[model samples]
Target: MCVRYLGFVLLVWFTGVLRAQSAALHCGAPSLSGGYLVPEQETYSHESELTYACDNGRKPAVEGWWATSTCQNGKWSHEPQCIDEKACIPPTIPNAKYTEKLNGWYEEGHKIRITCDEGYEQKDQDATAECINGIWTSVPVCERSTQACGEPPKIPHAVIIHQEYQEVFAVDSELQYECEDGYTVEEADGKKSIFCIAGSWTKGPTCRIRPGTGLGGSTVGGTHGGHTTSTGSGTQPASGGGGIRPGTGLGGSTVGGTHGGHTTSTGSGTQPASGGGGTGPLTRHVSNCGKPPIVPNGEVLETNRLFLKYRCGTFYKLMGPETVVCYSDGTWSEVPTCRVAYCAVDTDEYPDLKHAGVKYIKDGESLRFECVDLWLVTNYSEGRCTDGRMTFTRCCNKFQLNTNIC
Candidate 1:
């Protein structure tokens, strides 16, 4: 160490001598922190160069951990500095500016708030970003005012009718909703539109079962919100649309009776309707959609004023819509077809086989078997089921003698 120090002193002395010869042309030693320079000297000649290295976990303020600086006309070409390697540089965001003071190098866990320029909007809830472990969190995006709202929120029992879903929506954009089978908007006459305003969507309607109807139109003796009254009893119309009439028969002809004046007591037709005993004209709801269309081999699982859900019978599968809707034009939606399905294997014909008992095997399914007795020839058999038919590949005899057959 002493030898190296003495050689460094000699080099400094020689540099001083050269500086004295051309005092105006020589450059003074450059200043550096958190690092050390090579060829330690008090002064350097014009056009002289030196390299610098930073301490551990630090790097030169320029490009890399080590850098070179040139002395020209008594000044260094680049200033040398050793900065923390974990320091974060400010991010550049288009159309956005930091609200707080920005530093050249920020230590870990630093935070900054940003604001969008005029005519632009922030895309995140909080317009702030934090630096952790030398890395900055995702910065909020600043988009034009036109792209203010994100994708529309989902509602219950309904789907937005969009050709393709989008991540963002422009202000004042409109979206429509289609209720699921057996459901309709609560407000039957109201529009089914949802609009994007500012950065949110307008309140949308709820999808509820249509009034005055049940699944498959099976519910009976129900009233239509007091709009109508039962027959044989003296009662005033709730809406004052009509008055009560006198009963001609002993029980005041069943409410909603046919024109012939014969009342059938089946009890299934006791639906909400306006009927009176007198000989006056009976008025029905002009917009009331009648019973749904019948589906062959398909029973109604759910029914409403304008919707019906049908389910296929056992061993039958539905090929089309399970639920049909009644449009405003008094037309019922297309009814689905019930096609026969071969989902089980028939074992009645194979009495001599080991699997004589009945067992259900779906189409395109199979079972494998081997000889039960080792004394008999080792034979394998497979029963493959397809379209209600099972193919028997081989059979083994239960007894090794003539009494047994395979």
Candidate 2:
């Protein structure tokens, strides 16, 4: 299709003298399925169809691309092209093997058959995967079968208190165990035991104890204590329990972000984010975006909110907003970044472009493109340089090579 279009374009250019004659305007051939559709005769006159019947494995790249051309005055009505059936790479499936009779490449209409190995089952009932365009429509899955618990798990520093236990136990069996000296169950209502159930084992309790004291605590879960013993002037009552049971006098311990918002114990109930009728001031929840996202060649600004502002270095202008706000939900808004102010123009787009410009331009500067000779700007031939990004629009020989219009 491209060759035929180029041929017509070249013919029209060579027959420049015939432009004044009553010759039909040529149509640029468009790529169809994957084949070429040239006119039957050189006389591209009125109504005609550049026809070609594609093979079984091939189909049109786009819907209803076929069109008959009718020369309305001096131009052809439609572009000529055909669709090409491209092949798709085979998909990889875990624990599944493809059938031996697989083709080298799965064409558009081809199908791939996969079977799960022994002791494995398909994720879905569909065993056949189709190749649509360059991607596989869908792939089957195979996963290992799950079974009940094989043996009773042994606990560290503790033994099962229940007697009716065996090597291999049934599912959903709840066992009882107690922690030994210097150690105690941190979670599970302050009890030491694990339930025989899927998805819950991953969250099994840990034997925890307080630091410097026998009582233990796990810092993995929860935040400010929900129900506290008290709320002193310097201590803030925690709403999210940091551990299973509240330890003794957790005074001067700050919660949330590291902005000096400490919580104290004075035997009290829960406190809200704002004023909660307690002697302790409203604990400001600082935004902890984890190792604040760094902006290239930029410095962060000081702000009491969850987020910070970033500004580019000298000679560099900000590409986006400068301020990042820290929200009340213990999260920070998206951080703005800075980049180099150097911008480059793509000269390959304009075949007949002429300019005495360098490869890169300074920030906030515009490049001039001469609109003389065979080059035509049609009112535009300049581009601005900002944040290492260039927006250029240049026209050549009355044709738009590349432009950033609108």
Top TM-score model: 1
CA lDDT, every model vs. true structure: 0.60, 0.50
Predicted candidate 1 versus true structure: per-residue lDDT over 39-80, tens digit per residue = 879998888999999888887756556889888777788766
After superposing candidate 1 on the true structure, give the runs of residues whose Cα lies further than 4 Å from its correct spot.
Answer: 1-30, 38-51, 62-79, 99-103, 144-406
How many clashes in candidate 1? Answer: 7
At residue 174, candidate 1 shows an lDDT of 86
Q: What is the TM-score of each candidate against the true structure?
A: 0.25, 0.23
What are the RMSDs of all candidates, in order?
A: 23.6, 29.1
Off by over 4 Å in 2: 1-291, 296-298, 301-307, 312-321, 325-333, 337-343, 355-365, 370-381, 384-406
